[model samples]
Target chain A: MALNVLICDDSLLARNQLKKSLPADFDATIVTASNGLEALTVLQTQDIGLVFLDLTMPELDGVGVLEAIKAQALDCLVIVVSADIQPQMQQRVMELGALAFIQKPASADKLAAVLHKYGLI
Target chain B: MTALHFTEEQRDCLQELVNVAMGQASDKLARYLATMVHLQVPAIKLVDTQQLPQHFAQRYQQQSVSLISMGFFGDQGLRGEAIMLYQLANVDVLARLLEYSDDDSSEAEMLTDISSVLTTTFLNGLAEQLDNSFSYAAPRILSSRDQHFADKLAATAQQWQLALQVDIRYQLTDYSFHCDMILLIPGEAVLRLRQMLDQILASF
Candidate 1:
């Protein structure tokens, strides 16, 4: 069975950029959410195995989603793809259980490397 | 009052960092628009918040402009707002570049979207160079029509006496439209950023 993946971001452009960068060889059912609230709904209702999350969004931000995942013990891996590339911000997310953080304008090779590092690819 | 001061070396370092961040923003825009975007060497200034109105009035008087403002926070208590200013007359050109249908309402929406993307990209680029991460709030359209630029800033101008302002001009190579993006870091955040700069300089 193919893995389930979720891409959450408020920008349509950003979501499309990440979606376009996904490797063709990767087999997964990709889902999308524009905000933290929508992402949480998807998480609760779907068996999403991986998520590509953006840090800034309306309604709820990436950190809020991480907190929700931790609170509920959601079974999934999250990799943050954001433009807020502050080191302290990166450390905070890592501490919150994100598998990795990638900077935007996402690239295929970087995405593939992170996935491989976590044995997700 | 002791004027906020930055050593020549510190000023150079900060300017260089802003240059790199602006480069990243320009590249993203170039790719998105599939056109050449020219970025000017940013002019950096440290000024009192109260004096910003005079600054804006002198530089942008009588010109209609749009301002988009967003707040960002760092774990080390570094916080400030990023504001982008565009001439209202350039809205039509911008809409064309972004490939949006030309209309009044869509033009407003396009400005917000472009502002959000540009601010996030630029801030993230700067943070990446400093090896820091920031949490940003959703960008808000502070103003969208012809107005005194300084008046809009006055609404949320309190909280800090000193601020570091970086002014950058983005112009398309083949177009007459241009934008002036100003990044303002308040007194507290400026202090924290200087400390980080010191650490970075020490390592080099």
Candidate 2:
């Protein structure tokens, strides 16, 4: 079974980089949203298994998306890949129910490790 | 060159780059201050350099502020000045947090130190992504006891015809610290940055 993945970020370059870094063996159908609103819209309409989220964005930020997911009781895992790597932010996201946190410019090994730990890949 | 335009994709790319770079800089400041750092999405704009003083006056709307200016240049023809603005009212709180005694010399040292972390760290992050490196001139305090923010900025603003401005804010809610860091990439350097951004986008 393939996991449906949603990569949410405002930057086209960041979206492309993350898409390229996905491990070759990860079986997932990837969708993308430019900002948090679009991300929530997709989550409502599609069966997304995992989300690779970015922190700062124009309309509604990554944290807002996390809040929405929790409020709606949406069933999905979130892994934040953001440039804001403050420990405080990491703690906040984890408390918000994110499965894992990866820093921006995420390496393939790190992504793979997180995926493997959750047994999602 | 070419009206200093950044395409939609280019603009998005630049904003993200600024976001990442600012994240690093603010995180460092947070650790140094022993407080959590909050960041806003960076804003990117192309503006006429001659109007920079007015731009700062209108956007920031501060009567008097402290300004630190630093020059940064890379091997790939990208060079610019980074200006960090601190509200006069807020610096005292930050100074106390850093444990600097209340004195003019101490204030200058503290201001320059903060500027270094914000400017160098951010510029280095940008250069790394572009596969380049930057050298920086020592950061200088542009505002003095009697000088105002806009007046100090006007001296250097006229040198460039157009500038790519990236406005970044780092907020520390705990300490009531809010700073506005702006980067001005002028004329030819703006063209160089556009080309570099395009190459990064194309590589994928």
Candidate 3:
């Protein structure tokens, strides 16, 4: 099976951008969840390897979802995509076990570098 | 003098102050967006919470506008001393100007991603300035979206005693957008903001 990726965000726009930014040569199947709650549900059934999560959402924000993922002991890598790019928030997310943090509207090249650094690409 | 009012002279000074601050904000945003943006000061209104909606309606020509609101609390805590409001158009154009896009995605994500970037950039810049000058960390954007004008103003009314009102217009090419930033704070916080402003003025 190709690498399964889960994208969780409240904004439809963010999901689209991450999908578009994926490296074309990478063989990965992308799945999306509208919010952290939905992401938790989808994650329970899917063998997701990576997650591109957003911090702010209507229900069960990103930080909450990260906690849930941790509580469930799911072996998934998290990479946060947020508009709240405060250094403090970044540090907090990193401490929570996210492999990386990508500010919003990240370019494909920038993302590719992040993925490569994580050995995910 | 619980309810402070700006005299005509003070109003002009405040207007110029906001203009300079906004000019710097736009310049920072332009750098982030990689495009030029022009801002126009249509009018500045000093109103209480009750008069906010009517002012917003008249400004946007009775059209429901998409609004983004954020609050900043400095030194003394929850007495939010400053806040920001950006029209959706200003945000959208800024995103476009920044060339925000993904190679293969639906239009929706493109917009969301751009929205995220715009929020981050605008908040970060404003926060840095406030923090540097007033020891106020950049305000945290609690949330951002295409919200109705009435809903936005109503929600703001609950949180603050409206301190001041700034009406601004942003334009580029064929697109035009308007914004109303209503500064809100507790009585004490308002005093701090004024003091901060005085110090900033003195330094310059």
Name the best candidate (by lDDT): 2
Better of 2 and 3 by TM-score: 2
Q: Compared with the true structure, what per-residue lDDT tens digits does model 1 show for residues B60-156?
A: 7777778888898876877788888888777788787788888767877888788777788888888987788888998887776755667877665
lDDT of 2 by residue, B1-204 (tens): 335688998898888888888889989999888898888888888888777788888966745688999999898688889888888778788889999988989988998999998889999998988888999999999995568778778877777667667777788959777878767777788888889999988877
> Deviation in angstroms for A30 in model 3?
68
TM-score of chain B of each: 0.92, 0.95, 0.63
Please, what are the lDDT tens digits per residue for candidate 1 over residues A7-121?
9976555566678788887888999998899999999999999999987666888989999999999999999987555555678899999999997657789898988888877
lDDT of 1 at B19: 64
DockQ of each: 0.02, 0.83, 0.01
Residues A16-111 of candidate 3 have per-residue lDDT tens digits of 657887888768999999888999988888899999987756578888888888888988999997654545557778888898998765458878
Question: Is candidate 2 or 3 superior in lDDT?
Answer: 2
DockQ class, candidate 1: incorrect
After the best TM-score superposition of candidate 3, give how far the Cα of residue B31 lies from its true spot, in angstroms: 2.3
What candidate 3 gets wrong by more than 4 Å, as runs, is: A1-121, B7-12, B41-45, B76-148, B173-175, B197-204
- The residue ranges of model 2 lying beyond 4 angstroms of the native Cα positions read none
Q: List the candidate 1 regions with Cα displacement exceeding 4 Å.
A: A1-121
